[model samples]
Target: MRSRGTYYLVYPLVIFLLLVLLFPFFVMISTSLKPVKEVYANPPHWIPQTIHLTNFSDIWGKYPLGSYFKNSFIVAVGTTIINMLLCIPAAYAIARLRFVGKNFMMYLFLIVQMFSPLIVVISLFKVISRLGLLDNLLALILTNGVFTLAFAIWLLSGYFRGIPKEIEEAALIDGCSRFQTITRILLPIAMPGVVTTVIYTFISAWNEFMFALTFITSMEKRPLTLGLYNFIGRWAVQWQYLMAAAFLALIPVVILFMLIERELVQGLAGGAVKG
Candidate 1:
């Protein structure tokens, strides 16, 4: 029932998405179900004849998946909370306050965020080692917070600026403390940006490879991403086990994106429009 031109434009993208995006998920699941022998078959089995459910058990027994998962949880959750706490107040201040060198400060933050992790890996490793914190959870948690803080501040600051000054002004007249004003008035209104920050921090920490690889030498302190890579390289690549773990690795991020779909969409859309 659609016009020809409209269908022509939409169909390509639809098919492209299906082939490029959906195909990998299909492959991941299919590979996960294959037996090790079938996985190595000369002609890859499109539909795996043998369903190898024990891949999960084999991986669990072989790797320290539980420890890796716990380390990731600690880093992701800790950094998210730190990002929210540090970003909200800092964003409120930057967006709402009139101060000397405001633009200069913003520029400083932008520079920090733009700086790549690779360039500073040696410096960061030295700091971690000097702090006597190498191979510890604190190092990971703090590293995540430091790395992601600028982005959180930058994003939430924009959202705070979008909020009208009148709301906080009224709260101030009513004798509300700065803390209370931030907590009660600004936070609810800037919920989308907060959601965005949380999503970014969680995803960044959960998937971070290079920092963990450099900072965490201990097996128990390693995050899932590094663990997964190590798991793959330990022997002949167990495609079935690797795929199963990859799917598991993806679950939290997928759930997070689904849950905050609306907020994330709005936040991203609003930022695009502003830009």
Candidate 2:
């Protein structure tokens, strides 16, 4: 009887939490579909009487949204690729090899994760200016890759260590070279961690604003965050168009999560247990 009562109480709490979390998304969609006049309607209409679907078209035609999306995609994918190339090898070595300062290297990576890019942005700006990469997508790619690498190394190292060493030894004894063993054996086993790392790094790169805003100067090179600036002016803001563009921007991330929902869950759970 008491357990049943507790379940009844818990249900309302869970429902309330879900509503709280979802309320902003509902508002964004509602505002996006509302005509400009209906957006600030007196008494605040939760639902618009007349839907305006042209906001999407207006934002796309009025702004360089396509270029912004392309820049963001290029930076995110480039950053993920570079991070994987660097972190995976380092993670494998950390997990399998017995080099001096191995423990120190692990500690250093962990410590590096504690620092935010904001702290070093000025120094980075100077170096990027010197390299003539100040307004380039490569600048964002390099910076994002550097920051995301520590997390990848830490996460992949834990996952790699969780794999049974005997499997690698068996493959080696059967005439497989060390590189072959890593490529053919370990990488397949550690795929979940790889997916998690890639998704996380990609998302981080995608949503990056400070570095993108600071390093990128050309209008054509701006990412989605900067692209949204078109909807705001010194005098007034275009709320409807901004909301529509924001909603559209969410599609890629939502699709990524939906497709890899299962792997993401399992990878996080496995990392928790393994670590």
Candidate 3:
């Protein structure tokens, strides 16, 4: 009876919080469908009087949105690939190998996350400039990979540590080398955590605005986040088109979550306990 009463109390609160969180999404959808005149209507409304699907079509015709998406995709994918390549081996070493300063190295990685990119952007810019990588997609890929590496290693190492060492031992007993054991045995079992890390790295690279803005100068190389500026004018903002573009930008991320939500949830739960 007490549990039932608590459930009733909590359910309403949870519903209210969900509604609050989803309200902005509702507004974005409503605004995207509103006509130009309706967008600036005297009193803003939750529903569009007339849905304008052309806003979606118009953005592609008017802006270089396709290029923006391509650039964003390249950078995001590149960042995720490089991050995983570096993190997997580093995480394995930290989790399984006994070495001097192992704990200290793990703590150092944690400390690196404490510093924001803003503090290092100028220094990074100078380094990129020196390497002639400014205004290049490779620059974004490298910088994004570097910034996300610490967290990825830290999270993955903790997840690796949580797995049973006996499983690895059995693989080794079958004449599988250490690298083979990691690839064939551990990676498959730790897939949820790997998926979670990949998703986080992809999203971070996709949504990154600061590094893109600083490193990229070519209009053709702009990412989706930077391309949103095209909607803002000197006098008035294009709300309908902006919302439409914003909505379109969200589709890939939404699809990613939909496909891997189960793994993401499990990874989060596991990380919370193990990490």
Q: Candidates' TM-scores?
A: 0.89, 0.89, 0.88
Tens digit per residue, CA lDDT, model 2, 1-275: 56888998998999999999999888999999998899878888988789899988887787788888888899999999999999999999999999999999998987897789999999999999999999999999999999988978887887898899999999999999999999999999989878878887888788888998899888899988777764574367878888888898888887776765665465446546433
Question: Candidate 3, residue 22: CA error in Å?
Answer: 2.7
**Residue by residue across 1-275, what tens digits does model 3's lDDT show?**
57888999998999999999999888899999999999999988789988899999998977889999999999999999999999999999998999999989977998896678999999999999999999999999999999999988877887788899898998899899999999999999999778878987898899999999899998899999988875574367888888999999998888876766665455446545433
lDDT of 2: 0.86
Q: Give the alpha-carbon lDDT of every model.
A: 0.85, 0.86, 0.88
Separate clash counts for every candidate: 0, 0, 0
lDDT of 1 by residue, 1-275 (tens): 68899999999999988888788889999999888899999988888998988887777877788888888999899988888888888888899999999899888987798778899888888999999999887887888888888877887898788889898999999999988998898898888778877898898889888888888887878899998888677768777887898898899888887876665555445546543
Off by over 4 Å in 2: 255-275
Q: Could you say which candidate leads in lDDT?
A: 3
lDDT, ranked from best to worst: 3, 2, 1
